[model samples]
Target: MSHVTSPTGLRYHLTHTPPHLTAHSHATLTLTVHNPTPHSIPLPGLTLALPDTPTGTATPHTPGPLTLQPPQGWTTHADSPTHHTLTPPATRDSQPHELPPAGHLTFTLTNYPTSEPGTSTLHLTETPHPGQKGTDNAEPLPLTLTTWPSGTIVNPPTLNKNRYNNGDTATIEWEYSPADGIDYTLTYYPQPAGSGNEKNTVTYAQIQDHSGTAMSNGLRHAVYNTTVPLTTDPVPFILTATYQNDTRTYTTIASVGEPDAQFGKLQVTGHTTLLSTTPQTLTANGSFTSPTEGFLVCWTAPGTAPNKLTVNTNGESRTLSYSICSGSLTLPLAAQSAVSYTADGVSGDQYSVTWIPLGHAINQ
Candidate 1:
């Protein structure tokens, strides 16, 4: 059947028209919901389930677990060991927005059927999608899945990290069936407007294949990447497996970010008076750190080339030394730029530096 229509006049469409997959084979499936009714309708909630220890084919693969990687932008929840409910992201109004009379939405997911080989019937039930802050457990439509027997199935790659900072290291693991020969390639697109885009192919001779476990189809290989640094946000990576002039690509996404350093209190621990050729010091209320190659530079005097005080706050608290023209230095309110630290090694604007004088006004 091309699609299934519910009593509510909502149409459900699954990839492969008839909604079928091969046993022990990995495939990316897409589910689309169409609103064909005269009036607007809510998005149909979807709950996908995988059959455990399926039985149909003669040569069943070793019993293993199933893993599902959902598409981006869907909020997923595991209500049971093998059942997951997929919800759409909330709108700005936090209201249950209705889909236009002729609107539609599509979601994709990658399925890893590594368990016993059999023509197991998969269930993808359609129900009422959850709203702002509630659970939805209503279903009037259901999409059916059928599995066929297969021995040589293409597998998708798995990433070690799901979310990480930009400069973190990650690895990709996948398997390939033994054919005339197999080739592999890795393509990645970093965030921040796709700064780095590159691809590399690994020939069969360069592969260090290992024995397959019960959960894999054929030989397995792992690629360690120390330079999987992301630039801005979550980035998707692709790994292509080519064999017998056919190619299949698998994708995995990883989120990257670095927490911003907060501004802390700095107190002048040394005497209030300072000499032109002498040095001054300040201590932090707590441990200070500069993730980047940045340091704090306090504006000691008001003149051209505002005496750049050298202050290094890497691990422990440090001090600042400057050549101020001996004058009574009164630290103003912290709201002003009395002292600041650089975040990107360029501008000291990320954090505000506050200084609490010891006894009296500081003089240099």
Candidate 2:
């Protein structure tokens, strides 16, 4: 319900009969105009204004012109799809009609579509008759129109990849066809597998249809990209879509896997130096090594902790058993000795290693 008074001492009351309307449905608005002046006034016309159609691929059905039922002896003059003008008989006695002081008129607007779900301000204005001039008789009254949800989700959530290594990028996509007047919301959550707690949730509101036109094939789509960090367990993801008074949700899983081959390479610099107070000796066990360069390999499986290998040289060949642990081995190099070694007993696909000079630092 809404009320507005014009300068001409006329009060207008607006109301939507049913109050709540659904998208793609019909609605009726009733307007009552009251005259409060002491003298009879000539009736002019009325106008109703609606908001522009939503900007996108799907266009709303255009509404037809407005219809007006004037009081007895009054005739409709100007009529347009959204505007109408009514006037009393031009000459008194010639089917003359006028609103006596304190009189009122009631009219209804029917068959309007509530397809788009949202707030629409209907501007109802009273037009002035010829020779009538004043601030009070010409203001437009604002009435709020609200519509509810009448649509559903057409496309569910989908992920580009189900498996990701630490620091890998992944994309999620979904789509929804909106009701005539409703907007949609999308939310995503990434939680650790088997954990009831949610790590984080991302939300997107008023999501627009990427497809410029209505997707005749199915629901329109939207996409989101994210990076997966290293984790011990698989991550469960959830996507939720909401529109008006309705909500839909979906879920999927992503697993963390071992590092790739590129991540397995040992990172170290050459020309590194080693120092020792006493004659230090380094031994290369089942680990693989290069004579002119230092090398070490370390890696962890999807479910296991990470470990590495280290070798020291006394500038001579020495056999040592390798184990998965963190430690430093120092060895003195013999003059002009070509040191070489190999991992003759080590085996596994989950191992990542790095090799550096006996005294050099290792970068993983």
Candidate 3:
């Protein structure tokens, strides 16, 4: 029979189909024991013996124990004293009989035989027959049993993080390969830095779009985050992913204990003051150059500004005013350039013209 070896070790499959067997008759299955490992092994022949005296004592000597080389799980159990009697027939209460100067003999396994899939161990000890000096018996040997390996086996997943900006949006993805019989659950925890007295918590969620790729075997997905704004402090994070119904296994794919990737700056910059000017009236409010998407622009005014005037807002404005009152004001260069002359001759309320550049010039 052929078999596939697992990288985790300790398993051998019997590939061939079983043959039809007659009732009460033994069936011998032909199988090829192949060791997935690259190394080879050598095993010893089994031997069994009995003691002549009721009390047995064998001279101290190391009889070679059974050896099972790679790709082999076959052991021999001869009908010798050690193999046959673990507990002597209680009725007789009689210990086995043996001869002095007893030497070792080899026995090949028959009856319950075959190189089947299983685990095995052997015990090689010495004992001297009671009242019989120099006469010793072999110690009892061990038994072996074979079975299939089962339960979920999981390999660690790799996480990939891309560059993102402050206030911008980015996603974290993970990939994992699971065994044929296993299922998994992945949880993601994103904690921003400086979540203390200086900063507020940012609420985020793990989004699972119907048309998205999953970290595990497409079994499940989810999102989590706070409602406050995210910060730049070293925020700790954790992810707990598990195989379905696996209460006996655990592994860390990523953790707060290890080095983590930081979030992007999410920079935002635009006019913050509302323009109650004379022309090109507009209203706009939203994130500025967010990482996930771009900015948004909206305008609403009773009548368009007199000239091609620029519009700006502080995100929330519901009223507009245009009354000439002596006061200090701030304006963008684009707005100032669109205007002609202001009453330059005025005392008590003097004019202070400020210039702001709206276009970038390449270096020479």
Candidate 4:
């Protein structure tokens, strides 16, 4: 229930316009055959071929000689308007022979130089002269041919490492937008150094603050405030984007605090007498190691200077100072009376201190 024919014939404007053909190699089709009953439409003898599919087919060879035109007094003749097999349509008394009421018809399909551009379906017929009436005759249409191929496209760039700790903050983000001219580079590597490579490469327009929207879920943010140190180190993360011409590299994997706890080591060991006599009892043993294997301890003094250092450590006190210096420690131990220290738990240094002596200051 719809009708509007004005493809302006020429085979419906060359089977639907758009440079139907160009150059020494033709491919044109404009066939608009519509006689909606009012009478006058007869032109038969059609043949367009193709049939041999067992999962292998490539056919195209029909050039030099193919002409069918009608747009004036309407008088055409064609027992062989030339057709040399473009393959596909296989059937119709073996096919060939088409001429109608001369209402409309335009054809100039050629191809010969070994063609592979595909799409086939063209066969029209309408023949009934001689007290004619075989359904009025003229109906069988199909024409399509388009070829354009050659390509390569790869676009992948993203990274956003938001939340961070152990030194306050950090943020690093990224993204990409480059058209064909091809030549890119953006890189990063370092985080508990697990090693994935590409530790450096930058030039996707030189990305630092990367203010050009790159956090499309590939998250990479950097906002470090500073000073979050006491022990434990290992903030070795990575983010990469590469194409320094070609080998392609896009990666993002992070790690902070696990590579032996980043970087730290402070050790100043045991017993700080500094000269003790009456009521003598001063000791100072220390240890603090990092690299993931943590440990801690501390002790300071100078006659009633026990500020807060009493973690005698397990195993009582054999004058102390054995495993108390495990991973890291900062020593400034001055003494004369009571002093003790402990911290040999390990793992980024846990922390411990002890100091006591109230009766050894020249009996003041």
**How many steric overlaps are in each model, in order?**
2, 27, 40, 75
Model 2 misplaced stretches (Cα beyond 4 Å): 37-39, 48-61, 65-67, 77-79, 91-97, 129-139, 151-364
Better of 1 and 2 by lDDT: 2
For model 4, how does the per-residue alpha-carbon lDDT over 15-74 read when each residue is reduced to its tens digit?
A: 523232221244444444454433344333334322111112354344445444543334
Please give the ranking of all candidate structures by lDDT, highest first, separated by commas.
2, 1, 4, 3
- With candidate 1 superimposed using the best TM-score fit, by how many Å does residue 106's alpha carbon deviate from the native? 1.8
Name model 4 segments beyond 4 Å from true.
Answer: 1-46, 49-81, 84-121, 124-135, 149-364
Worst 10 residues of 4 by lDDT: 1-10
Better of 1 and 3 by TM-score: 1
TM-score of predicted model 4?
A: 0.18
The better-scoring model by TM-score among 2 and 3 is: 2
- Candidate 1 on 1-364: residue-level lDDT in tens? 2357765566777664223455556665566778887788765456776555455445544323434444455678877766679776667887554568888877655544444333344466655554522225444354544444344434677777778765565666666554433456656665455354333344444444332334444555455453545555666667676533235567777677764344599678774432122223344222233322222334333343433333333233334433333122333222222343322222333223334433333332
Clashes of 1: 2
Locate the minimum summed-lDDT window of 10 residues in model 3: 285-294
Better of 3 and 4 by TM-score: 3
Point to the candidate with the largest TM-score: 2
Q: Which window of 10 residues has the lowest lDDT sum in candidate 1?
A: 326-335
Task: Please write out the lDDT profile of model 2 over residues 1-364, one tens digit for every residue.
Answer: 6677766667777776466566677778787888888898655455656544532325554566545556566666544454556555566565334568999887677776665665555676666555565534566667655555554544667778767765565676776664553344443334345655435555454345233245665556677665335353465556665544334556767676755335466567875454322221234333333443333433333333444443333345554434444333333334444444333333344334344444543323
Q: lDDT for every model?
A: 0.50, 0.54, 0.28, 0.34
